[model samples]
Target: MAHFVPRASFSLPGSIPKTYFLGHHHSGANAIKGILNTINLVIECRDVRLPLSTQNPKLESLVAGRQRLIVYTKSDLCTDSPAATHTLRGLYGADNVLFWDKHRPGTTGALLRKLKNSARAIDALTGLRIIVVGMPNVGKSTLLNALRSAASPEKKAKAAKTGDQAGVTRKVGTSVRIVDSEEKGGVSGGIYLLDTPGIFQPYVEDGETMIKVALAHGIKKGLIADEILVDYLLYRMNHWNPGLYSRYCEPTNDVNEFLTAVAKRDGKLKAGGAANWQEAAARVLSLWRIGKFGRYVLDDLSDEAIRAHQHLLVNPHLSQNQAKKLQREERRRARTGD
Candidate 1:
């Protein structure tokens, strides 16, 4: 087994509690999977931007055979209605799912009501330990703060000291437990939330994989929302997502032609009648940040993980590393049909 590292250390009040959080893909997938290997019923942030197929099974396995709820976090930003979010619960099974938006200061939406309703649904489990998990800037920290605030009326939760800047919650995750939620005016029940660092594609030799996680979480798009942000994302994603050539009328084969066309279109040509190729390159990057290129999937679909999944398919019982080493064994089995 790869040695597990603690993202954030919890203040575990009594014996390590049972309840936890759940999330799939980009950040929380693998570790949430590890948590599911232990217990049931975790609190998870809902990211509609990510498709179900891309969600890592480590987290999904936990959702099966027990109670699960979906918090439609950042619902304020969604183009969908509260009724639309509610329909998902019906589709997933009435009691199986729920939605909430911690982004809104007050819990006015259906999901907040659902989280409040979760208590009545599962009467026996009073102290629900929630492992609220998600990627950075997807509001994992923000959700926890809101939940903490709603629960306590006086002296609400102090902001968890995370940065508003991108990738601020770096390093092994650290968690803060709401040991006392009675004051938050929430149902006076037993619940402790563990916050974790946003997961990302691990480095092989460089940060190439991390850019994929950034893409999955909409951080790149967010950065592009501003004119300056557009420039940054364009620079990175131009080489990152070569589909840029087709998006605008530009030469696909020649990098120079593509850059020149982008500058000419933006009317940023040099006084010497030369295409401002440098500026064009900058413009392309800006467009992606600004969402002109359209949404695309970029996560830990790296070669290493794909290879690992394929290896697991053959050696159903081998450990992740052992399976990688047993490639010759696989070849032998393939040759012998044993």
Candidate 2:
């Protein structure tokens, strides 16, 4: 865990490379600017498992003062209970926050109904132009397709590209009309969805956050070595859900030895009967990524951590100890409702 910490926090020193952005500025600028120009509503999508880490606060600043809605995608992959909804609402704010599982067929209708109900102020003649933004592999494209599917049953082709891997939607700010007046058989039916590439902050300030983003597949793979990611995942699984992991393999803190054991058990082998540790590492990561280890929240969204993060964001020059004090005071105020 200690050895992997540096890779996770590399962004803290402004060392994040171009590969992370992957030409989002050049290719996706049109969509972002278009959103700025024509967007009536901003739908910010996030992975349910890592709501806080995957959020791009910088994007929020860009679209500040707009009618923004936070929709947590990939809800099916999360293991959180019903109460988790309330937790998210409390952290993000009360209205216009929603949970969605794209795999569910009726999700689009439900989302549209929610949107219509929320946007009562907007006249029926006015169409809804929404831009979906999030980190990579958080299902922005899938959500768009779902909306397209629900809006027009005759449209069979997918409106946006989608895949299990990150960076599939390299070109940002592409517009796809989801519903038109013809489909609704009236003059009042126009809904458009703008798709944007996954945009990440220039620097990620924390190691644990980077790890969580990687685990969520928000960042492109191979940016962080598989071994380092697997190591962190193993540590987290052991700490958080040891019983589920122990069912597959014996508990061990050593990443290398654990990978070897997993390789041997799964029959992943090199030429000379040695365990294929790399393959084993990949397998372990895949299971956790797909929710085999159960649901887990990567961000420590406790009031104390939230205040610490807020304080750090606002007072970047503050020392670590000073930030801690600020966090404590905020927690006290929250407890007293002050």
Candidate 3:
């Protein structure tokens, strides 16, 4: 087993990759920039499973100056507790963040009220144009579809295509009317939504965050080795609850051994009856992705991690150089003594 590393120990990248900013004329960060001046409210969608890591610092940096509301999406897939929600509210600011599950009835109504209240200060004379932004596969498109469906039964057509994979929305699609004053029953407003391509900052200095993001399907598949991901999942499950994988294999901490046993039991064998452990590892990860094991919030935001994250969030007075230096030193200290 690898040595335990606290979530607070890893360093975050200062900026994202330039490629994320480039692409189709109407897509990427450019789309948001073009309409930045016009957008009244920004709805920042994040995976409920890894709220902190998948918030995308690069995207946050751009919209930092705007009137923004953080929407924690995919609540249906997460097993977050009330205490966890309280902790998140404290971390991201209670008034600015909200939870959402598209599958639940009346969820869109709650979100609409919150949006209207949050953007109450903005003068949306031309109607409120709310832009939905987030990393890939966090259901940006799916949320837009839900909103459209709830707004009007006649407007049941899908505005954006959605899939279990990432990067499905390659370009910026035309804006759709999400709410109207004539909608009668729901929240009254002239609300429009634009869906943008999934973009990320260039580098991620931490290993655990990357792994959690991948496990949550925020990052595209095949970018990381399957076995490595499976190994990390095994470690996380063991740490969270011992013998979590006992139903699939014998109780043990050896990831490889457990995978081998699983392969043999499932009759996944290569030539000559050798166990196809790689296939078994991929299957394990697939199950985790679909929440077959159980709902999980992957980022371990313990008290220590929360304190450090809060410090980073509230310390805006620190100079850019000073902030980078502090992050570097924190990572060094976390690694050196451990």
Computed on alpha carbons, the lDDT of every model, listed in order, comes to 0.45, 0.70, 0.69
Candidate 3: residue 168 lDDT (0-100): 85
- Give the Å error, residue 272, model 2: 1.9
Off by over 4 Å in 2: 1-19, 25-31, 81-83, 118-120, 124-126, 182-189, 313-338
Q: How large is the C-alpha RMSD of every model relative to the true structure?
A: 14.7, 9.7, 7.4
lDDT of 2 by residue, 163-262 (tens): 8877788776466777665345522446678888877644456656776787777776765667778877776666665566665566666778788877
Q: Which tens-of-lDDT digit does each residue in 203-238 have in candidate 1?
A: 111123223334434332332223233332344344
lDDT score for residue 223 of model 2: 57
Report the candidate with higher TM-score, 1 versus 3: 3
Candidate 1, superposed: residue stretches over 4 Å from native: 1-40, 62-64, 72-91, 94-109, 120-126, 134-138, 150-158, 161-185, 199-214, 217-338
Question: Candidate 2's C-alpha lDDT?
Answer: 0.70
Q: List clash counts for every candidate, in order.
A: 25, 1, 4
Score every model by TM-score. Answer: 0.48, 0.82, 0.79
Give the Cα error of residue 327 in candidate 3, in Å.
Answer: 20
Worst 10 contiguous positions by lDDT, candidate 2: 4-13
